[model samples]
Target: MILGWRKRRIARHAGKKNPPGNQEMELVIPNHFRCPISLELMKDPVTLSSGITYDRESIETWLEAGNFTCPVTNSMLRSFDQIPNHTLRKMIQDWCVEKQNYGVERIPTPRTPVTPIEVSEILFDVSASSLDVDQYRCLELVQKIQKWGAESERNRRCIVANGAAAVLAAAFDAFSNDSVERNVAVLEEILSALNWMFPFDVEAQKSLGSRASLGCMIWFLSSKDLSPKQDSIVALKELLACDQKLVEKLSDFEGVNEMLVEFVKKQICPTITKASIMVIFYMVSVAYSSSEKIKLAFVKMGLVSLLLEILVDSEKSICERALGVLCGLCSCKEGREEAQSNALTVPVMVKKILRVSDLATEYSISTISELCKYGRRDEGKILVEALQVGAFQKLLLVIQVGCGDKTKEKATELLKLLNPYRAGLECIESVDFKNLKRSF
Candidate 1:
C-alpha cells in the first residue's frame, strides 16, 4: 500500500516522469513562455531592445517597466530608446524554443508590494530636550508609541518610526562602560517592538529594527567592563529568533542580511539557518580570544566553505568586512594552526587584500599587525611586509590630512608594531607618552 501511494504521488507530479533518481522535474511556468536564450527556464524573464521575435509577454512587461535585460544572457534589452530591427530579429529566432518533453506551463502573476503600516503620532511628539532620558524610561516612552503604531489608522501609526529612532539615540546615551544589564534591557524592549511592528508595516518595522539593532551592537561590543551574562544570552536568543523570521520574510533587503551577519558574528546563537552567519562571526571574534571552544564550534558548523566564498566575492566592502572577521578568527590561540591546516587564511589575503579601498586597506593592515602580535612568526612577517616603509608613508599622509585623531592613534600603533624601537623612541619624544608612562 505504501509503495502504491508513493508511486501515485510521483505520478501526480505534472509532467515530471522519469525513472527513480533520473526523474525529470516539471518546469511550472505561470504562462506558456520560455526564454529563447537559456531554453531551460524562464526565471526573471525579460526582453531585449531589438525589435525581435524572441520576446514573451512577460519579457515585454518587464521591458515596459524599465528592466530591459534578458535573464539568461544579461544582455541589454529594451530602453526608452528604440531597439534596432536587426537586433530584434536575431534575439527572437535565438530565444524562442519549445521543449516537447516538458509538461508544465506557468502563468505570470503581478507582484504586490507589501503595504507599510501607520505609526503612532505620539512618537513624533518627542522633543530634542527628551533625548537625554534614562534608558528604561526612554524605552517605556517608545513602548507607548509602538502600541499606538499598531492602530488601524494610517496617520496615527506613522509616528512610531520617529519615536523608535529617538529611543535608539537615548539607548546609546544610556549605555555606559559598565552596563550589560541595561544594554540587554534596551535590546529586549526594541526586539519586542520589532516583533510587533514587522508583520504590518515592513518599512517602519525595518527602520525601527535597523536603528535599534545597530545601537544595541555598539553598546554591547564597545563596553569595556561589561560582558554577556545569562539574561543577556536569553535576550540575544530572542533577538536571533526574531531576526530569523524577518530574514525569511524579507531576504531581498541587503540591510537585513548585513545586520544578520553582524549579529551572528557578535553573538553566538546555536540556530541552524543562521549557521553561515554564526561561523563567519565566530571566526572574526577569534582575534580577541582564541577560545578553543569557539574554534571547535566553527569546525562543527562547517565554516570553511563560507569563508572561502567571502574571500572570493567581488564586493570590496564585503571582502574587507569578511577578511577583518576572518583575520581576527585566524589569530585565536589554536586558530593559527587550524587556519593553516584548513588553508583558510593565505588564499583570502592573496585575492582580496590588494583590492580593498584605502580605509579598508588601513584596517586590514592594522588587523594583521594585531594578529602578528599573537600568530606565528612567519605569518607576522607577512603582515609586517605589507606595512612596509612606503605603505607607512601613505598611512601617515592619510592620518595628517584625511583622518581624525582616532585614526592617527591607530596609525601610530601600526608604525610601532612595524618598528618597535623607533616607535618607542618617538613615544619618548612626545610629552603625552611621557605623561602616559608616568601614570602607569
Candidate 2:
C-alpha cells in the first residue's frame, strides 16, 4: 500500500515539485501479486474454499496452526482443500520477468504431491533388489516422500495409507544385510523413514510389534550409532504403546531393559528420554503386578535414583511416567531398598502430590506406601522422613482436594500411619478420616 501511494505521488508530480513527506518513489507491488497472509508476492498461489488465494506455504502454515477461519476474509473456512491458481502463477511469472530491474526472479513450478501409488512403486524398487544401486535410488525416493509428507497433512496420510511401514522395514532389512558404506547411509534413511511412518500405520503398528521386528529394534538400540539408536527407541515406543504383550516381553529380548536404563542415565536426547520413559511404562504395566523378577530388574538398574533425578524439574508428562514406573518398581523388596538409598526419594514423592496430575498423585501415594510398607529396617525412618518432609500436610491436602476417592482413602491411610510420628502439628488437627474410608 505504501509503495502504491508512492508510485501515484511520483506519477502526479512528473516533471513537477515533489509531494510533501516524499523523498523517493518506489515500485508499487500489485495487490493480486501479494499473498494476503505474508503480504509478499505469491510464488505458487492456491485458492481455498473461501475463494481466497495464498501462497501454498503460507496457507498451509495457517491450517497447521489450527486456524479454521480464513486469514483474509475472517469468515469460516469451508474446507482445507486447495486448488492451484495456474493463471495467477503464470501472471506472477511474467510480472517477475517484467520487474527484472527490481531483482525479482521467476519462481519454479512446484512438484505434484506424492501419491499412494507412487509410494507403492518405490517399495517395489526397494524389494526388486538385483543390485545395491537400485536399493540406493529407492532410499533417495523414500527420503523425498518423507520430506513432502512432513510439509502437509494430506501427503502424510497418503504415504501411510499405501503401507510405508512395511516398505521402510524392508529397506532396513535389505540394507542391513550389506556392509557397504552406501548401504549404511541407506540403512540410516530407512530407520528414519520407518520412525516417521510407524506412528500412523494402524495395521502395521500391530504387525511390526511381532517378535522378529521387536528383535530388529532391540538390535538397533544396542548399536553405537547415536542417530539411528535414538530413532529406534522412538519407534519401539510407538510399537509397544499399542501392544501390551510386547511390552511384557521386553525381558524376552536380552539386555533391552538395561539398554533403556543406560539411555536414561546418559541423558543423550530429550526424545530419547521421553521414549525410554514410555517404554518402561508399558514394560512395568503388567509386570509390576505379577512378576517379582521384573521389579528386581528395574531396581538393579538403579532406576530409583534415575527417576528421582528426573522428577526434580521434569515436565508434567515425564514426571507422571516416572512416578508410574516407580510405583511398579517399588513393589518388591529390592526396589524399596534402592529407593531408600536415595535421600531425595521421600522428599520428591512428598512434593509431587497435587502438583502434576491426579494420576501422578496416585502413583506418588502408591510409591510412598510401598516404601513405608515394604521397608524392612527403613520403615520407621521412612515414616519419620515423611513427617520431616511434610508428607502429612500434603496427604491431608490430597484428601481435602478433588483427587479421586481411592486417592483420598489411600492418603487417609498414609496419614493415619504417620500420626504417631507427628506430635505437635496443627496441619493434622483438622484431618478427618470419617468420610474418606475405603468401602472395600
Best by lDDT: 2
Per-residue alpha-carbon lDDT of candidate 2 for residues 369-394, written as tens digits (9 for 90 to 100):
88877775887788888887678877
| Candidate 1 lowest-lDDT run of ten | 431-440
TM-score, prediction 1? 0.32
By summed lDDT, the worst window of 10 consecutive residues in model 2 runs over 425-434
Per-candidate clashes, comma-separated = 26, 0
Q: What is the lDDT of every predicted structure here?
A: 0.42, 0.75
Looking at model 1, how many pairs of residues clash? 26
Query: Where does candidate 2 stray beyond 4 Å?
Result: 1-43, 47-83, 90-109, 124-140, 150-154, 170-185, 198-202, 288-290, 376-378, 425-440
lDDT of 2: 0.75
**TM-score between model 2 and native:** 0.74
